[model samples]
Target: MPATRALVLAAAVICLAAAGWLVLREATDPGLAAHPVPGMGEMNAAELSRDGYLVIPAMLREVYVAFGATEEAVIHDTLAAVAAGPALETLYLDRAGAMAGGGLDGADQEIHEMELLDLASSRDGAMLSVNATWRVLGTVGHAEHMHVRGNVYSAALTLAPTAAGWRITGFELLDVDRSDAGTMVAAPEPAEATGG
Candidate 1:
């Protein structure tokens, strides 16, 4: 009888410890912005924030995947690959739109490497703000390319949540021009240009 009681107590303690570990991990690790269950999108910002601040990461991840995946080399023969990963998407992003400019094309990392440092994100009502430092390093048309770095770029975007949690619908990139600036050499200047 005593053995049975001890076994039950050990099991309960182990279960409790595991649960506590999961909660702590989720609170600290900014990477897993996953909403395993469908969020009740009917709630307002305050309500959503109450349930672990899920909106910001979800919206940001979508943007990262969308933007990072598309890359075409410029006049230079150099290649740039952008991927949507923890380095840029899940963790390491800031309220100022700060994130690493990763050249990750799905699983394929681009030859032309670009990284965004000190990335941040902010939300004003339905509008989400992204700011980050831009750095470009790799080969241009030549073999060595040009080792260059620039300041942070700011972007103000409007985000919306569908049944699939939060995703960016309409966004206004105030200073940065996505068409031409999204490149290796002739890309947008840095945070200063965008007033980030």
Candidate 2:
């Protein structure tokens, strides 16, 4: 009876050891990549931060259009889709609502260029900071016709990965430079110069 009990206890120990090994393997498996953006799962902290920066412009474009259109439901949906945490989503939705409420018949925004300026990451990979330059065309209210408002924005972003995917945890506009859109004039034909 003593021998049988010893054997049973040993078997139980072995089973627990095997289960632990499996869990460890799954946690550290380098090949297990799951990310919505292709090639993102393979990126290290800096690279992930850069990629996260690149994705922001696209997300902003969608939300801007939705808000400009005064589609509250769309704004809520877009914010929820891009931002993961509940607090973050609510904050963005409120901002979007404000933009929509701005005195304008309609507005259109386009991100002309984006460059990742810098990135910092936490040791545990739980947080990231991304600094970037975003050149944008801000088309505000129309007069006779739509006009362009050139804007260069310096943005600082905090990002994290959640169950849904990568999302913006924080946002700050560091600086902005604005300029009036230049007017273009048509060239005169040679026929008028000759008095034809």
**Highest-TM-score candidate:** 2
**Candidate 2 lDDT, 115-178, residue by residue in tens:** 4444443323445666667666654433334445666777666666666665666767788777
- Off by more than 4 A, model 1: 1-43, 47-58, 70-151, 177-196
lDDT of 2 at 85: 70
Looking at model 2, report the run of 10 residues with the lowest lDDT sum.
30-39
Model 1 per-residue lDDT tens digits across residues 27-97: 66533333322333354433444442344434433343333333332201111111122222322232112
* lDDT of candidate model 2 versus the reference: 0.56
Provide the overall lDDT of each model, using Cα atoms, as 2-decimal numbers: 0.39, 0.56
Deviation from native of the Cα of residue 24 in model 1, angstroms = 34
How big is the positional error of residue 149 in model 2, measured in Å on the Cα after superposition?
Answer: 1.3
Candidate 2, position 98, lDDT: 66
